[model samples]
Target: MHKKDNNIDIANDRNENIPTERISTMFSFGMGDFIYEVFNGIFGAFFFLYWETEVKLDIWIVTLAYVIFAIWNSANDPLIGYLTDRPNRFWKKYGKRFPMVMIGTVPAILTLAAIFSPPFLDPVQGAWIYFAWILITTCSYELFFTLSSLNHYALYPEKFKTDRQRRRAGGIRMALALVGTAIGFIVPPLLIEYENRASYTNMVWIFVIFNLIFFLSLIPGHRESNYLKKRYMKEKEEQKEQISFWDSIRIVLRHKNFLVVILIFFLDSIIGVSLTASVQYVAKYVLEAEAETSIYILAGFILGALISLGPWLFFSEKINDNRRMLIIGVFLNTIFLLPFMFANDLFWLVIAAVLLGIGGGALRIGRNPVMADAIDEATLNSKRHLEGAFMGVYTFFNRFALIAQGIIFAVVHELTGFNANLPNQTELAKFGIRLHTALIPMILTLIGLIIFFRVYDLFPEKTAKIKQKLKELKL
Candidate 1:
């Protein structure tokens, strides 16, 4: 029998050595983001466009469906988090997160296909059907996504305990995430033509297959090491007193560092969703460009992000502070976004995409490491190791950004007198599209940067102290 160690391992206590196999495993795990990004890109960039343009649903109905879905999405996250974090016999056999992840894979794939495959009906009847399907599919998708992603993310701090390790792993992860974004945003434009249902359905199927492939690739990587398994088991044994679900909510809400992280992510989500949702509009209406033109713009963004990842990684390592790096990245991204409001041709748009991509690389790479630091601090402070709870609450607020995106688009289009029935929009409507694509995202990011600098207190020294405390607590 193995004896449980009360003292948790710290980076300083061990040699700075990672097994070669573990590195490979971690990189393979990064591919899982491909599935998530593809799905996210499709839903964020095209789902509303499809419903509003192809199916010709009223904007308010679409917004109302999303608002309801957002509520449901938020409520389910904490419940899943609370349940997953609790000690259970199943985790002893299959690991804590892998089972939930696997359980969600098939349903996530099926529902993704359903979202794009609503049956033929009149516009009014189809609107109700579309509304119902959106609610069902989005709620279902988020449920399993939360289950898998929360657990997958929870493992990061435990597995990569040192800053050096996190930077290496996180850099690769963000790179893969961008690749997924490319596949999600770039390829579909090539497959699906403007308002072509058959092509759209085909594209959906292709994404479904890709989702299955990448998510399945994560299984081997999702396995917990013997050391982690033992640590979790020990923590479970020692902490027999379970906190109530409401109490878990209260604790996470009260955490200043966690709140800062959520706020930044929340604002970022709004900006990201707005930009994505407006891409097709920008390509079609603003540039008066072909449907395929959006692919080039999105490709430019992805390529820039991929190319700049190395430099951002190095800069973050040099500064040794994720918060400052994020602030710098978001500020630069905001500057890049401004040019888009004035862009009328493909050349300038692609140029702006590249610059935005560079900023995005820094933002994406720094986000997780900082979030991991926050989770570590929360775990130590709470003394409960509730990664799921914290992630759940974080995800809950993040979904609100989706709700905001829907509302923003609906209101903007309505106010600007955008009619999907028209072959061409009025000048005001075109300006509204530009505003949604660039101006609004820039404004939101600026606000996020301000809050991060002023309110988020997880500086390098403070983070170091928190990690040191974790070591002292042996947690």
Candidate 2:
């Protein structure tokens, strides 16, 4: 029988005896971000561009695919969280999250490959074929993505066990994710020609190989310990009654703090996906640059982010306030993104990208700690461990970013008379791309930040109480 030790002071405890080991563990854990961001960077940055431009799929068909895909994508998060959040035979041996993470990862990568490898077909006559391919492959990717990534996210608050550790882990994670995202943006332009389907397929295969290598590396970080297994088993026994999935979701939804966090998460998701997806258009239509020139522009953005991270991490540690750090990041990102609309040359464009990255970096560094804090509060209120459930709902809202992006593009493109068939866009269409690239995302991010600032009340003092209570409950 596993006994819950109420006296374990996880909040203050530190592994001072083996500092090297602790750093290694945190680095390994952060490596998972590298894997996640590579796929996200590649997929988000190029998926729409590939289908609409390269595959010559109609913009309406693309948007329709996104809508249908979002339905399945959003639907699975809570279900996967609910189903996998229970104790099973694997709990004692393999640990709960590790197995789910493992199960979801490889298949997701394979499906991502499938998404880029649609059969050669005419865009006009074979529209449905492309639509079916996008729907099936993207939905399949989302299912595995939610399974692996949600559990991985749930693992954070569980494994880190304290605010200081979470902040440290978050900085490292964001740093690696930035590197992966840079590769996603930079590599494609270097390898892909706008007209070559084979180049896109080859790029994805390279990503597949890169993803698998990093996948193997992340296994060490995700390995569960005997202590974690025992603690999970004890928590399971204390659960007493398992609520229905809908009820569980309602409980999480009713938590005001968690809801606010997810709303902000939803908006940020929109900003991230839209900005990445619009990069190629901005480079080609707006800047009139070659395919490879996009790499230099992306390099500026990524470089700014990577360089600014250390300062942001230091500031986060100094303030010890995730909420404030996040707010500042949002404000800066919003302000900086406005320049994208006015930047005419490649130099000015790269400068805007850099400024955008500087602010965005802080937001990236601060979000996980803030989210973990919210989850801590929710768990204390619910009196059960449901990180998986919370992440499920959180991710569900996040997937709506795709839908939002799709709609924004569909409406804007149709109204502006943007033509995928044409080599050069009209001035109105160029303006539309700029709106999708910067203006819309900037407005959405600002709105989210305002709402988050006004409604969210989880300050340091309140979070300290939540952490103390969670520790007292041995959760």
Candidate 3:
């Protein structure tokens, strides 16, 4: 039997005619990308570099800190997800997700600055202090970021009800995200000279302010529609079984499509961290370029991503299959990245960056829509509104990328005998940098592609059924 309430004919009540104003307002939410990507870019690209090189901490110490941070992230993200997914009395007044977003903004800003500004101490004392600080600051940052970001992510499937709408909004969102990523990559190195702590701290201040401004800009766009709220409340009233937190995790893990998506995300996270973390090293060590020269290489990649978004969107639509498009994108990205393993000249590296960016665009554009499809499918099967929970788990596993990154850095540095204090690295160190930049990521991408082909089954027909079920449920 269909769960029905009040004979309100909720399907008829839906605002099918999404207003132009609403679309514009909703799309403006992409501004949140500035906050998301800037922090992500800074952390991924420079955090290790700053700590190990500038602060003069042992690389192994830095690696251990991140491992602990990853554990904290894994624990907190799902807890936050579970908490947010539950029906809240207070959320009724302000909206479920917005309050979390609001509460998190200030703390996020403060912690971001704190991560960059460690107090003065001797290297041994500072290492311990930095370890403690990293743990505290990272947990604080992830808590707020997960609260805000998971909600922001949940809003996508709710707001953009149709695939077409998702595609359009997602394109704009990815474009803005890449732009922020570009700025995050290109601007930081320009700010921090080699071993210059003061300049690095100054860059942190600048980024913190930028994060505050962009995060606040999301306030207006976070308003939940009355229709969605009423629907959720009615569903809550009609819910028969209340699943426990562990059950939710179990269910998410058992979800075949979600597993596929998570694995893809997991692998992609490695690729992302590898590139962001290694680009500066590649420029400085392998190419023997100036510190600021990495900016151009990163810019080439991001600019290519920005330029290629539209075409990727067009091609995905033309192909009418996101999964296929994603496979092609990943394959091509790997292909393009292969050249980077050997490219020592600035010109060739820039060329490879552009091609990789084009492939990156394809990968970026398809991820959200595909994930939304998975969430929709899971919701239909489970009869639960678990976007928060799902995204939480999604992010939880995604944090493994950082752990993997730490391991990569520790192992590669140890193997290659990379010493930050050295005036010049050995050829082995350069080779390790190249491996992180290209070879490892390419290998991971291939593994991801193999898994994707073997497991991911969210083709057009499956998505159509999911959408049809949602329609019947008046969701």
Top TM-score model: 2
Task: Report the C-alpha lDDT of model 1 over 1-475, residue by residue, as the tens digit.
Answer: 2232212222325432222225666676677676778878888888888888887888899889989988888888888988888888666667777677778766877777778887767778667877888788888888877777777777677777778878888887897889889988988888888867667778898878767777767777667665666677888789768788999899898888889889888888887998898999988777777679999899889988989999899899999998888788778767788989887789988998999999888888788888998888888888878888888899889889988888889989999999887868999999999888888877887877787789887889988998878777777
Question: What is the per-residue lDDT of model 3 for residues 312-365, given as tens digits with 9 covering 90 to 100?
Answer: 899988988877877887787777889888887898889889988998999888
How do all models score by TM-score? Answer: 0.94, 0.95, 0.94
Model 2, residue pairs in steric clash? none
Error of 3 at 95 (Å): 1.3
Clashing pairs in 1: 8-474
TM-score of 2: 0.95
Model 3 / residue 456 / CA error / Å: 1.2
Ordered from best to worst lDDT, the candidate numbers read 2, 1, 3
User: If both were scored by lDDT, which would come out higher, candidate 2 or candidate 3?
Assistant: 2
Candidate 2: misplaced stretches above 4 Å?
Answer: 1-21
Q: Report the CA-based lDDT of candidate 2 relative to the real structure.
A: 0.85
Name the lDDT value of residue 398 in candidate 1: 89
Q: Best lDDT goes to which candidate?
A: 2
lDDT of each: 0.81, 0.85, 0.80
